[model samples]
Target: MTLFRGPVQAAPAEPCNTFAVPTVIAPIEGPERVVWEPDGPLVPWQVAGADDLWVEIDHTRDLLRRFEAEGPQPDRIIDRIENAGHLVVVSGPRQSGKTTLLHKAVHSLALRLDDRMRTWSNVEQLVPAQERWTARSPQELSHVRVVALAGPRNAPAHVAWAAGRPLDVDQVHDRILRKVRETLGKPEVEDGHPPGSEDLYVAYERLSRQLIEDRTVLLILLPDFGWGGEGLTGRFYRSCRDNARCGIVFFVESRNDTGCADDLRTAFGDELGTENVTHLALGPMAEGDWRDFIDARHRAAIPGAAIRVAAEVTDGAPALLTGASVGKLRKVLYAATQHAHENRRDEVDAATLRAVGRAFEVPGPDQFRRDGASRQQTEEPRP
Candidate 1:
């Protein structure tokens, strides 16, 4: 008999079926206000404004932590942020774990926030800021700022903290909103702006300029940015993307094939201008990604060879990998590993992979692999 180690987590029982894509939520007509502890059951999509946005961000952060994901491995975006000089555009298909990746990246950035006087809050615990922070100099800490935008589809968030300090999510988000409102000459005290006036890109550019002046660093994470069309925020972001000196690193997630009208391609044009804006198309996991995904967590310590075969059969689709009902890949792998162990093997073998794949009704390696980039620059706009 074998025992599991410290980090080996059980696969989640539920499927990754809830869509984060906020539908065509028409911009609210009047000045949007932030109301905390609202009455009645409210659909997240219907509410809009700063507090609501705050609510959305808070909800988004929580929803992710609620799941038991196999630990994510370090990727190009994480590497680039640490090294600097890159704004990443993360695009992927519907239900492809793009939001999850964004959350992981923010968590990484939070680890870099660098404040000993503050505490980092996770879903279930309070972490010391010093343990999570990573900055060698006060100057480094001052310049590097990270903010996550829940965007138009969700409510704008208004997390407040003490003055001139950013050691917590509330502080970082509040500071971000305040600075933008200040730059726009709006009252800094207001939690939200008038509808269509909460132009995030405008706020982003303003913060970028201030950082540039102080030689500081900024990382802005905008997950599910469902705003496009000739909106105020849209053009603001476009103009900033054209500039070479915008000194901010952006991690944005959008529909893999967002409309041309959205101008993401235009903003991140041609190898990201100076690689200042790095556009990465995320699709199915590569065979190796699958291997790493499974291997990262202590999921029965299945042999690498067997895991690779399992990954191949799924064709790297995150939906299939995560969805409890999609391919049952997690359960299949677990059973196969147990079978191999019972056979007195050290690793999963080809026979086990086949037997499991067949029994679990999962596809084989011959299934068509849909790379995310296949639709790049070719997906026609929806009518």
Candidate 2:
């Protein structure tokens, strides 16, 4: 089957003059020197440099190191998972490091299980249509597994598609179980597991058995599980709870409203309690992290071109922060520094930050206010 690939657009070439703010004086004592250059064919100054901002990109390695060094929190997730139960639900605000935390967990697990365990992301690639068919041969199935099902928040098309499906609750459950069985290469049921025989749970047990027999582990990554109805949520939570041998079910979600977490708690009740789940929240990176990032970038620089670029972008969202290029960031940094040099200020101040942010069209207080209002209006239910 042909899959749709989204169209690619060339990055804008012209520096965004509107977004460029007046450069501020160097915050630290340093010789007056040019920090950036504009020679590349690619847009030279698009993103902010590390030193020019209050926040930096969320680096998984740094986070893991910090967590390990500082010791776990009172409500630490890794500790909770190790001591308590198998199911974990990680929720956080949009652009929070929920997905990154999930990936980190998978990485840690991979160290112990190695090739025996496999990690799959819900958003990685579309499941092949042929997965709907029953596997007729043993070669088709896998062993122990971990699966993550992620969907984007507010995916109306996804919601509509699921709602339009004709399958009842039981049918939906059965189909999911069958798919699991096929993926694991287990013997197909001549007469399927009982109508409500906890088939979802049973399928997990079968997967575990395959893993133990093959001496391998399976890790499934399910992200975006928050984008469905309560019933679907309930079933998923229930399946995780009842299946004793299932490796782990990691539920990744944006921390929008506490409603999503509350719903999961209400739906699963005793079977899938909060105590059994792990909650990981990804927040903004600190200035220190940004400093380290800058140091690294500086090391990578071509001698004299090492300049600090710091501009607020997308509310310091990790995706957006990391999505931009070094050159773009360098341009903003250079522009800001030049402005500061011209102004003869001792240090870069908040005004310079704001100017740089505005010049880049990074959403400011005004844009944020407008966006917040729009979000409220859209979420409000009609009478």
Candidate 3:
């Protein structure tokens, strides 16, 4: 029943971690701030889509649960990821909850990693072969390493091989190695350091395999990988896919082409084989779907701020809510909740929503102003 067998290193003199360990991985050229840091628990509607107060919609809950439950289960989907890595394609229109869902999934996976690391710590000689794993603090969640596979718009500054020239596999390999080192808090060395093989791909393959040898999952986030008849992009995808032992999740905007997922599947299926790729698409939210989300926020997160929707508020009640997109809906509701709190209103009725709409300059129907609700719902704050 020995799950892990590695060389044991002496424990540190003190329990506290002395050196900087990579507890998080941010895109080298993405958002200026870290991805998973939450300041405090605020009203669910007050935060942006990517914020910690994300509402679990019907489509995303199941996938998120799977990530949370990711462990050493041999029969699960994660086992497939461990074998040859896996690709998850998430497609949605603009403002359709893509970023929110992906962020939630990554957060869930990190939590699972934290739990597994706790269990691993209880066993002797079960630590990773790498010395960096021995240097982490108990408070740090370092089991899961996240990195962006491709930057947004595939910018040249972020991706080294993304210039107008032909695809250089060595350049791609070197870029990935640098990011991985940066994630592990290791000092970056010059090209071909400790030169194993002249082939850079071989070097990258060995490092990736060793990094995940302790059952750690390297989660690669790729945003908006537009398919353009399999030119340099396809080569880049193939090069990365073939070399690394990492799980990749592609977030694509499907407003332009609804078949973006199918395109990716057909393109990578031959290389990855069948059942290794799963695609999830987020579309418009139904009335019941969004209503449940809002109600759940009220019941669980924001019980004090009761915002009852009027009966007249049908699927298209808030005319300013453009496209029923979750992102847009969240923004509008956040503004409404802010206004309600500022104005000292107990309930966010149609009138409050109308005021929010006017302030945001979101044109609404004339009838919406007349359909204000007279009743109110309230909840006392917990002592």
Candidate 4:
């Protein structure tokens, strides 16, 4: 994880994923208001002003832990996209940090592809000396272009793309075409050419061939992807697949609750059967990990608070973490921090969390345990 600022105090370099308090937060004047505002699909390090409350602690272990317990690591998914040149379906319960993992992968890829990082005279000052731009595979691509789009969950058919709404099919096509034109320049249309006669395919074919020849990778990320019948989504996927010759990879994100996984399986059964397409389902992590994450987030939010959050506060709040998505966890933490700020508390306590949980309808510890036990008894294992 790249830290946002210079270290005020040097701490012992603990092994990756350990809760060693990697970066010291400088004290802030007056009152601090911290919120986890997501700046699109870009990682915090890549986004300007998004690292105000950022900490250097690596949450990769948390992700890896979840993967080890629930599905294959994200590296395998990336490998399928990059090495095999296949589409990967990444499914998880909503708020399972699917975008977070993908953003991390893209950030690392950007770092590796940036030759300027190696050529800079003050490279150590710009990038941390400890940071490694290690190549993941032997066949390293020199260039990359990432186009991120999310699937419309409950969008109206009339809407194209709006501030909060996902992009529809037409908008998706327009965005892809715009990217192609920006990269490869506009193609001239013949004077007597008919409308929609192989122009789109020709453009994509040119894109595919140029990327292949230039050793550039085009990664298209489609998160929150749901199945809209053949006319809607089927044509979208089939069209891209038909035109893409090489150097194009798609990362499709979907919620497992929806029949999106089955839809993808049916649509691309051949690729799946051939192991060219892979699906990774993300699940929640252990309670201890959640506790650590909460503590880390708290420290990052407040900087130099008097004390860390009480452990029992988290231990007793399984309702906030158990089977809860990372999104919910962040919300709970955000509310608790706000509560602390409003109450002028140095550290978030049980009272602050309790009040926050009440607003979010989180159950008490006993009720959470009972529910967990019930789930264990009734729930079937996932294939």
Residue 203 alpha-carbon offset, candidate 2, angstroms: 2.3
- Over 304-381, each residue of candidate 4 has an lDDT whose tens digit, in order, gives 334446666776755565545455666676667666767877666777777777778553333222123433332223
TM-score of each: 0.39, 0.47, 0.59, 0.59
* Better by lDDT, candidate 4 or 1: 4
Q: What shift in Å separates residue 167 of candidate 2 from its native position after superposition?
A: 7.0
Give the whole-model CA lDDT for all candidates, comma-separated. Answer: 0.37, 0.39, 0.45, 0.45
**Between which residue pairs do clashes occur in model 4?**
none
Residue 322, model 2: lDDT of 40
Candidate 3: C-alpha RMSD after superposition = 12.9
> What digit string (tens of lDDT, one per residue) describes model 2 on residues 91-140?
44343444435544544443333322222211222223221111111111
Q: Whole-model lDDT, candidate 3?
A: 0.45
- Sort every candidate by TM-score, greatest first: 3, 4, 2, 1
Q: Residues 1-383, candidate 1, lDDT per residue (tens digit)?
A: 11122442322222111111112222369433322221112222222111121122222334334321212212222332333334455554543344444544444443343231122211122222220011112222343455445542212233222342222322333455665445434453243333333344345445455554544445555543333343323343454343212445555565633442245545544533343443444344344444443543333221132323343444444333333221144455556666665675555555666555556544333232244344533232321
Estimate candidate 2's alpha-carbon lDDT, on a 0 to 1 scale: 0.39
TM-score of candidate 4 on Cα atoms, chains taken together: 0.59
C-alpha lDDT of residue 33 in model 2: 22
Global fold similarity of model 2 (TM-score):
0.47
Q: Which stretches of candidate 3 lie over 4 Å from their true place?
A: 1-52, 62-83, 113-140, 148-173, 187-200, 212-215, 225-233, 246-259, 269-275, 302-316, 321-323, 358-383
* Best-first order by lDDT: 4, 3, 2, 1
